[model samples]
Target: MNNPEEKEITFVMPFGPQHPASGHFNAMITCAGENVVDLKAYPGYLHRGFEKLMEYRTHVQNTMLSDRVCILDPFSNEMAYVHAAEISSGVEAPERAKYIRAIMAELGRILSHLTWIGIMSSALGLESGAKIAWGDREKIIRLNEVITGGRLYPCYFMPGGVRDDITGDMAGEISRVLDTLEDKGKLYDDFVFFNTTFTTRTNGIGVINAEDAVALGATGPTLRATGMGSDVRKDEPYDAYPCVDLEIVTMEKGDAYSRSMVRRGEIAASISLIRQLLQKMPAGDFKVKWPMTKKVPPGETYFCCEAARGELCFHMVSDGTDKPYRVKIRGPSFSLALAVFPYLSRGVQIADIPAIYWSLDPCPADMDR
Candidate 1:
């Protein structure tokens, strides 16, 4: 207790690992007079030190760990790493294999986005929105199981191409899932976007201008939300992306609401892209023959893919050994984590923390890996 004439001083509060709405990371926020003054992000609570571990394992073994980086979008990491390896070894996957890879990647994108929607809605206290998003997400996961015999970490990608071919029934099942998701997407829009509470909480909050977005290395929906028509799939054009037509989606405002809308719009685009890939998919060998054990040439290669989160890139250095000398992953979440502190600190309320974090879609595993 203090005297009536005495003044009170505010201090910092840490919100984190166990916090209901903090997502998978921890944050320390300092406040003065009901306003956050400084915020710092502390990841690595879930870090697995994957890059260091990869050095001790063979190239094939490393793929298993790569999936752990971005648990939600494992396929993207697998594809990027495997593609880098292929480039280093001067090996090209069969044309059919490339198409199959594209299909898998797109399916993974849908699943990842659905998961993000569910998580975001849950953070915002929108129970119905979370349920609908997750209900749709499970279908995509089932599709993944059908394709790769596993739901979360399928390990379906390989150096030469994919691990296996997609069955005719599986391809049809994917189409059906897309249709179901399309119908549910409209419901999501009506229930989540049209809700007054959601609109007020998200709209015009944590806004990032277009020029600042570029300077800060923001990518994916975050950058797209700022009206930048940039997408790695279109500009870099890796794997089956070059073979398929794509439309990059963008929004005028870089606010939380705009980011959500951008993701919503891209989900539809991904469904269409998957449909096109399946419809035009040609029949051929799904795997190219390679030595059971081979050494990567002494060289370095870099490759990137437009993952659900953003542009996921990988740089590999091979020292003419079966195991890579070094492998570095450039995950998109790093940028999100770095940018979040400044935006979330002072001017925002505790309730807005989750909303802002979800808008950025921080995947701590990716950031700390």
Candidate 2:
């Protein structure tokens, strides 16, 4: 026991690999009683050194690595890496294929966000919200099964195009699924989105202004919530984004609530974009039909896609060989996860830590690569 006149002491707590809220990484936060004084992130528990492995594998084989690397997202990872390889190889997919790729990518975002909603809601003690969100997410996963013949990690996207094309009836089936999803979105609004407890709990916590967000390298909904209306899909259109229409949704507050709202808005926007893609998709050859074992010309290129999280980027270098010379991946979560420390300053309650972290939607696998 200390004397009454003594100053308060600060200690560290590791909110960790075994934490109930976050999955793998650990947060070492210095706390003075209930308030956090400083914080740091320690990631790498999920590290598989994925980039180095890509160097030794054939170009076609690396697709498997990229798609699986970021477990939370799907098409964006495969699309980004493939686009880079295509650039180096002087190959392009058919117009119809681009539209289909766009549709699949947007579907990936919807499902990823639904999973996010379930996990985040569960973190906040919203049990009903979790069940409803996950239950609806399954509907999208079923759609993936219909399209790609696989649920998670579809392995559907290839270098020049998708592994297969959608049938007319299958397209109608997806449209109906989106209709059900829209209704479910309204249910989410009713139960969780506008809930008093949720709003109050998230409103002011983990606030980061636009400048601070950019300085810390935050991206995706995390940066958009700060009123920076920047999205790779809008600013730098790739695949069918050039032909289709969508909004770069942003919120002014830059708080946890704003971030959640941004993701919520994106879900609806993606549904609309998918409908347009399916309707306007031109009829043509699905692919250029390049050999998987062919060598790419000696060159280097970078490609970026607006993934479910943010700009999932890839850099590829080829030396006129079937295998890549080098591959580098840039994941938004790595910087966004580190950015949380700035928000954990003195006077922030320890309880806000998990909420703030989830708001960034950190995926440690992205960092490990």
lDDT tens digits, residue span 1-369, model 2: 868998778899988778456778888889998989888788888899888999888877888888887877878898898899888998888898898889989999999899889888888888888899999889988999999998888888788888888875889999999999987777899778898777888998888898888888878898899999989999889889988778778999998899999999999999999999988989988877768787999989988888888878998888999888989899888788766444534468988887787878888778676
- lDDT agreement with native, every candidate: 0.84, 0.85
User: What lDDT is obtained when candidate 1 is compared to the true structure?
Assistant: 0.84
Clashing pairs in 1: 36-346
> How well does candidate 2 score on lDDT at residue 113?
93
- Candidate 1 per-residue lDDT, tens place, 1-369, comes to 769996656788877777465656888888765667778888878778888898888777887888888889989999998898899999999888888888888888888888888888888888888888888888988888888988899888888888889876988899888998888766888778767778888998888888887777788898899999989999989888888889788999889999988888888898899998998888888888756466999999989898888889999999998888999999998887767446544587656777788888878889889
CA lDDT, candidate 2, residue 307: 85
Candidate 1 residue 177 Cα shift, in angstroms, is: 0.4
Lowest lDDT block of 10, candidate 1 = 337-346
